[model samples]
Target: MENEDIWPPKCPECGSPKVDYERQSEYTGGGYADYWDEFQCRKCEFTWRSDKKTSYF
Candidate 1:
């Protein structure tokens, strides 16, 4: 319930609510990338998008 205002804006890799702009690790073949997706967790470094910003993968 840390980020209740945003509800479930969490990282699936670490369950952290520290999501932000996609990290540079993603372009370097970080193993997590998607079409139209551009968000990542500052804690676990997981990347993803949602809703209208959802990924094709």
Candidate 2:
């Protein structure tokens, strides 16, 4: 994806704009699991995820 499509999300805890995308994981088998992309805040060390099957990043 292009850089514009994968823009970093803000930190929910501190509302910091200096957030970074860490990684992503998706369930391969037919089991129940959530697809998500991990992110971290550079300012506060806050971590979070976007639990969507289809992610922009």
Candidate 3:
């Protein structure tokens, strides 16, 4: 679970602090109705979605 209070979440694959965060949209019901918190590690290029219940957008 990633917390918004925590900046630069560590990469789960590489454990690097050099990470980027973004709120992405997903296709749902034939439209972009769903959103997700995306995290990418700049160091290792590892990517994952936040498991937090709170939505970013």
> Top TM-score: which candidate number?
2
Tens digits of per-residue lDDT, candidate 1, 1-57, equal: 454656446787888877775323223244444334467788977767653322222
**In model 1, which runs have C-alpha deviations exceeding 4 angstroms?**
1-8, 22-37, 51-57
RMSD of each: 9.2, 6.0, 5.2
Evaluated against the true structure, the overall lDDT of model 1 is 0.57
Model 3 C-alpha RMSD vs. true structure (Å) is 5.2
Model 1 TM-score? 0.42
Query: For model 3, how many clashes?
Result: 0
lDDT per residue for candidate 2 within 2-57, as digits (tens), equals 46454677788998889888656665555644467789999999888876674333
Displacement of the residue 53 alpha carbon in candidate 1, Å: 6.5
Clashing pairs in 2: none
Report the candidate with higher TM-score, 2 versus 3.
Answer: 2
lDDT of each: 0.57, 0.73, 0.74
Candidate 2 — number of clashing residue pairs?
Answer: 0
